[model samples]
Target: MATDQELELIHDPAYVNAVRLAGKGKLPKEKAGNFGIGTEDTPIFPGMHEASALLVGGTLQAVDYVMTGKSQHALNLGGGLHHGFRGKASGFCIYNDSSVAIKYLQEKYHARVLYVDTDAHHGDGVQWSFYDDPEVCTLSIHETGRYLFPGTGNINERGQGKGYGYSFNIPVDAFTEDDSWLESYTTAFTEIVEFFKPDVILTQNGADSHYFDPLTHLSATMRIYREIPRLAHKLAHQYCEGRWVAVGGGGYDIWRVVPRAWSMLWMEMSSNPTPTGPLSPEWLDTWQPDSPVTLPQSWDDPEGIYEPIPRRPEITEKNTLTVEKLLYPIRSNQSSSVKPT
Candidate 1:
């Protein structure tokens, strides 16, 4: 569905040619000089195009299932390579799977989609790609890009052209704990649900923000990480009539964190009431020598060294402030609606 639109989003014809070349079992080994396929993060692997096609295909599957009403919600815990641009494959991303899916949703389903990103890194590529079209409301809640990689999610980077205020970037204070993290999500997302009024919701839920993740510095815990997927499911039912798609973003702690956290997300997509059961010994056995840490029977892991889910004021403040700031603009222009998809 998105192959043609993806070529446009990935502006460079050369990169598009490369994608085609890779698809046909002909990838250049010298490197995709400026195409972002040869960088340290996204090295020029042999089947780079094929692997990317799989990711894009996974996201497209979610789009197809949701648009056709076969599934009210879909979550692909292996997609969401947000940093990749139309041409460049930065950050281990060959193709912008989320963008391709969004383009497909807009074209095929004719649905107004709201993309909610909760990864620690700013979703700069996705936001920039649709920075001018108000039909897609791209909202991101991340640690200030100032302190992070590809840093650029400032609050003022709202939208341009028809999309002026539709793009919302909620970069939070650094070194936050579970309370701060949970509050931030609930706060900003609630108002977004009210205003965007999307026909469907697509989310990039990166697990790297977890305290156990090695790539990021934010201190969100497993309890909070687990809640994000749950909340995405809830939001789908609440506003978008249960049309939702959630994809995995950046998470490097493959053994200790990614598997457990993503399991919670898959369970959410399947509407599992209690995903508290022990990890399958069968699954755990597969991880033995490569992953030294045995998969936890239970997915729950506390965030702080001591403090768990606290009813403290600092956390409350974080959540409240995030919601309030996001609403500040919407309130000023109550009549302004996101351009219809």
Candidate 2:
């Protein structure tokens, strides 16, 4: 498990102590709010610190395995608590595992890092942590904060000072279907990697953009999940020499959406054949009784799973423009630098 010092790499020391005390029911009630505890989103509970620290430890271990060449890629499904900040917790995330892991990558391995976040919610904590540092580049694609929580991640919130052009956000509109969602993701990720080639790539796979997830309004499907990892895997090999570390982020539909989405990630990372057709009857039978919603029987979502989006064309066009604007600087620089020899 991660020690107190490791968490302090990205969290305030006092806040770490507060989480420890609150986990034991020893922190004063009035002071808990100061550290973002005892709220509807992140309630105090027994072993909260231990639980959060363990997730950080898992991501750290994944980083070690990939950076040290023990493995080319690793996944920590419990480790993408991207909303946790230095002194405060939000959105049910504590300890900010991805932030700690990125800091660890820089300090321990001396590697340039590229952080890619695809959660429905903004990866606010991770983005803010390295907002001023150029060595760590963060790219987040999520639903537009105009209608979502932690309403930041606008197209213009690039980095500051030397970190300018290092931070990228593509906040797609609501009701965006699979084609439009993938278009934005593929375009931004492709260009960003070309712009900022790094020694390692860290991906936060939130899986909450799926239509089944109740927390967000994006209309993606299993298709994006399968393709997300495929591209990440290909890019890791192409640019980072196969060093990639993946961690879980926000996915509220635990029974249906998350499992299938994350399974595709693992399959792509490990080079396993993508599973198609029906899901195992034995597996479905085991969990179907407990699930309030009927579990999907196939790997891919069926046709017409939801009503056709009436404004799909508009949403797609808007997202396309957003991606173009976000990448204009990089594209401009690239084009301007190319001169006839």
Candidate 3:
């Protein structure tokens, strides 16, 4: 479901060659700067293609597993390179793997797909790729591009003509807390899935947006991130007859954050809820063994999904009114008006 060999599919010949050149282990003066080939974030190390390919290959296999009905849902934690464009790469992604997978699904299985991204960063590459596409509905939630990298997923950037309104962007703020965030995401996703009703769901679950992530300032706990996979699974079962493909986008804290968040994701997909806050020994052995962070016996209990709906009606109304007032100008009925009864 994701890939780096998409040179023929999405990349310019020149840019693909540039990536290839960078892989050769030498660099021109601007090579490191322009290609992001050698930087603190995306160091152009040897086997760049291989490491990226592992992600892609794993994702593609997941797609097959889901398509074949072996599993109702599948996820690729290392996938979701949304920053890579058709002719160029940016934002730490060399190849737009999510787009590549979407195209593949269209071509091979003729599957109608809905791609939703909740990364702190906009899914610019994926959105732009499918801008004029009617078959794909792209929805994203993130800090408004004005404050983030690759700034593009504004509210009005809907798909064109037949694709109009099929695309939606809900940009929150850098400091937006969890309760408000998940409420918006759940509302939008529920509405969109009910309307478009695609054959499959492809979600970009990026842990980079979490509070612990070094890259983005957005605040999301492990529980919110964990809820995403669970929600994706539930939605797939509800709307798509249990067909789902998940791709990882931006989780940079390679040692501390990314693996734990993603492990919870895997647990969600597998329908096993491990006690939160402590990494299970089973998980630790898989992700780390030698390092000091050899995955804990159990993951620390996350704050847990925010209390979007208060237990009491009066309190729920109060929260709803607050959202209705603050978010009305921006989302209007799309969010605030849809308060749960």
Q: What are the lDDT scores of the predictions, listed in order? A: 0.78, 0.94, 0.73
- Per-residue error for 94 in candidate 3, Å, reads 0.3
lDDT of 1 by residue, 66-124 (tens): 88999898877778889978777777777788887887788877888899998889998
Who is ahead in TM-score, 1 or 2?
Answer: 2
- Cα deviation in Å at residue 31, candidate 3? 7.8
Clashes of 1: 1
Candidate 3: C-alpha lDDT: 0.73
Query: What ranking of all candidate models by lDDT puts the best one first?
Result: 2, 1, 3
Model 2: lDDT to the true structure: 0.94
lDDT by residue for model 2 (1-341), tens: 99988999999999999999999999998999998899999999999999999999999999999999999999999989999999998989989999999999999999999999999999999999999999999999999999898899998999999998899999999988899989888998999999999999999999999998999998999999999999999999999999999999999999989999999999999989878899999989999999999999999999988888999889999999999999999999999889567
**Worst lDDT 10-window in candidate 1:** 302-311
Quick one: ranking by TM-score, best first? 2, 1, 3
Residue 61, candidate 2: alpha-carbon lDDT: 99
Per-residue alpha-carbon lDDT of candidate 3 for residues 1-341, written as tens digits (9 for 90 to 100)? 23444444566666666666667776574855665556655667675665665666677777788888898888877788888776666778877778878887787788989999988899998998888888998888887787788788877787787777677787766656567678867877877787678999999988777665677766666657767777888999999889999888888767666777787888888889834655556656766766554343445533443343333344334334533443334365456658887
RMSD of 3: 6.0
The local lDDT score (0 to 100) that residue 253 gets in candidate 1 is 81
Error in Å for residue 289 of model 1: 3.1
Candidate number achieving the greatest TM-score relative to the actual structure: 2
Q: Model 3: residues >4 Å from true position, as ranges?
A: 1-7, 25-43, 280-341
Q: Which one is best on lDDT?
A: 2
